[model samples]
Target: MGIKVVKRHGSSFKDKLYLPAIAGGMKTTLKHFIKNLKDVDNLKTMQYPEVQPDDLNERYRGVHRLTKWEDESEKCVACYMCATACPAECIFIEAEERFDEKAEKRPKEFKIDLLECVFCGYCVEACPCDAIRMDTGIFSFTGDKREDFVLDKKALMKNERSKDLDND
Candidate 1:
């Protein structure tokens, strides 16, 4: 025969149930609500577009910009360092050899899928020639299809960062 276990229960006697915890939470909410009500003039619940942040870092990795040297030459030898270092793997680059002795190679087709980008700024750190940068401070990205987020050379070059980049 198998052994059986007995169950247990407490007699019905009640103190205040969870009233202190509830009161504490309510107190916190009321404190913040009253403070905001007192300082309605100082509160900035809205005021977008009218006020923005700052600009890019000296080395901010925003939208990629192919760097130009002092001689008006492209700095990128198309070594693919930026693509390899990108954590998001958003950077796609194709290199082509240059006939000119001064300019050895340039990107045949460089594309960055902003959709996949985490904005971690790894690509900017990996560039040997400073060919790519994420200077645009804009953080909002919206798209309906895969193609919409794929930022080509033209879009990256022209896409300007808002002033918010300087905030951080």
Candidate 2:
């Protein structure tokens, strides 16, 4: 096939003039302004910081956390699936021999570098045991130094310490 340059009419009266384009744009703006002016109380804009929004959806992936059993023991079997599946390679785990009857191995040292994490949730999906989750609903996190963001087993577990998890 060959490329063809076909001659066509340059511009119509409406296309040549800038007034119609400007008026069309202004109509949308004016409509929204009028609607907002009338429905001032029903605006979607939240006065953040003072009023915390509770609009996070069910599937919203926030921060990572290590889940625990009813007895407050860690559910992770130290299988290294989460670390293996992490695209950022932020998850680090050290396995140790567990004397408990529930599992043979447990994580001696579990760490996740939040700064390096991409929040892809691959680690949560890869775990055979329902150990790791990203349902803390805490997207806002801060750190003064590089080391501050590196969360260990204690920190990950602490994410679920005070907050009540949604059973659903």
Quantify all predictions' global Cα lDDT against the true fold: 0.71, 0.88
* Candidate 2 segments exceeding 4 Å error: 1-3, 6-38, 161-165
Error of 2 at 151 (Å): 1.3
All predictions: root-mean-square deviation over Cα? 6.2, 3.9
Worst 10 residues of 1 by lDDT: 7-16
Q: Residue 60 in model 1: shift from native, Å?
A: 5.5
lDDT per residue (tens digit) for residues 1-168 in model 2: 799988665378777787888999999999999999999999988887788767676566778889988888899999999999999999999999988787999999999999999999999999999899998888778889999999999989888622434654
TM-scores, all candidates, are 0.67, 0.71
Among the numbered candidates, top TM-score falls to 2
Q: For model 1, which pairs clash? A: 53-163, 54-163, 54-166, 61-134, 62-133, 62-134, 62-135, 63-134, 136-161
